[model samples]
Target: MKRRFLPVAVAITASTALLLTGCGSSGGDDDSLGKAKGTGGGGEDASAPASPSPKPAGIKRPEVKLPKSFQVEFAGWTNSDPKLQAIMDDGKERLLASYAAIIKGDPQHSALAYYSEGDALRTGTAWVKGFSDRDLTLIGKGRVYQPQPRISPDGSGTLFYCVDEGKGSTKDTKTGKVTATPAGDAFVLYRTKLRKTDEGVWKTTMVQTERRACK
Candidate 1:
């Protein structure tokens, strides 16, 4: 199975095979990533369970620069809790950063800015490695929407969202040939678990994914 996050770094076996598209979320059937472990606090100390010690520079995140041709829509999504909204907002930001990293084939940049030491981080690492190993680059367009979040009774945060990967292609850096990405009948659904680090920043610890008919 291909690992999906911004995109699966699966090596392109055929000239027709495309790499990952959209943002970070693993691919598979109801396969979940990461574990829930949090003691919740605000501002510095929310970084969490097994994160690395503070580096001299601090956790690096991306500035998120989207292509002007790109379009993103929320699609009838809203949240009532101000705090939850903030967290969700951060989650989307991280997703955007993830997308940038995958498209750029720079998982290290993403590792520093987003994702902690967990399944999410692992998935991101694999994707970057896979693509680099094959000397392939993913090219595609996508939009996100329909994000709904649930707060655990213990106050742990979880989120569900969708990514629509439109038409695109993958290019072989070696041959400089472009292969059209296979068209999909539906969008991909993503389930993510979130935790605040000791620094009070929300980070994705785990991600689960599956494909379903677009509504």
Candidate 2:
């Protein structure tokens, strides 16, 4: 999901500002963690299922529905630790919820709010609004891969991943015109922070995306 409004470098800086506002004074922490390498490729398609998967006995998960025109895949995201795996799963859901909001032309979509809070919520809302304001929507396929997740001693967590947008494009909502995105802008690296709630759902609190940061 590259935006056409600003240059990539400028957008990266602005997005960082939006997501890192309250990330604490320990500025070096994120830099060090960002260097960790992740491994993964190919993921299950993100098309909505006819019936949602059964929820775990005691946990509550939101149902996310996306139009068939848009698809996302998460590759090699398994973790040996169930807790870490849960974080990755929710992070994937959070991203889908955001894209769903954009495609639906709703900046304040409830599903998006369900998986996000704090800086992530605010910035995610604004990002969706950008497309809606321009009467734009996305179509085609997107891939998220190479996820590296870590949990802190205090229960908070961070995830780093790469996104491939080469097969995705933006469409005019009213005019039905599709614009191909540049190959150079198709790859991005993302870093996000999350926390688990009492209900056992992990919600994203912050995010940072760097264009051309991945191959």
RMSD of each: 10.9, 4.5
Residue-level error in angstroms, candidate 2, position 64: 0.8
**Candidate 2 clashing pairs, residues 3+ apart or interchain:** 42-75, 43-74
lDDT of 1 by residue, 1-215 (tens): 44332232112111112212333335542123322122121122222222112322475554566454333444434467866775676677666666566556676765335644466666656555666666666565555566667666555577776655544455566897666544452355566778877766677776555554233
lDDT of 2 by residue, 1-215 (tens): 45454322233334455454555435545554455463233244343322232354787677887788888777666777887887888888898898898889898999899999998898888887777887878888877777788887767989888888788888887899877667878777788889999888889988877677777
Model 1 deviation from native, Cα RMSD in Å: 10.9
Highest-scoring model, lDDT: 2
Off by over 4 Å in 2: 1-17, 20-28, 38-54
| Model 1, position 79: C-alpha lDDT score | 63
RMSD of 2: 4.5
Residue 1, candidate 1: Cα error in Å is 8.5
Q: Residue 62 of model 1: what lDDT?
A: 48
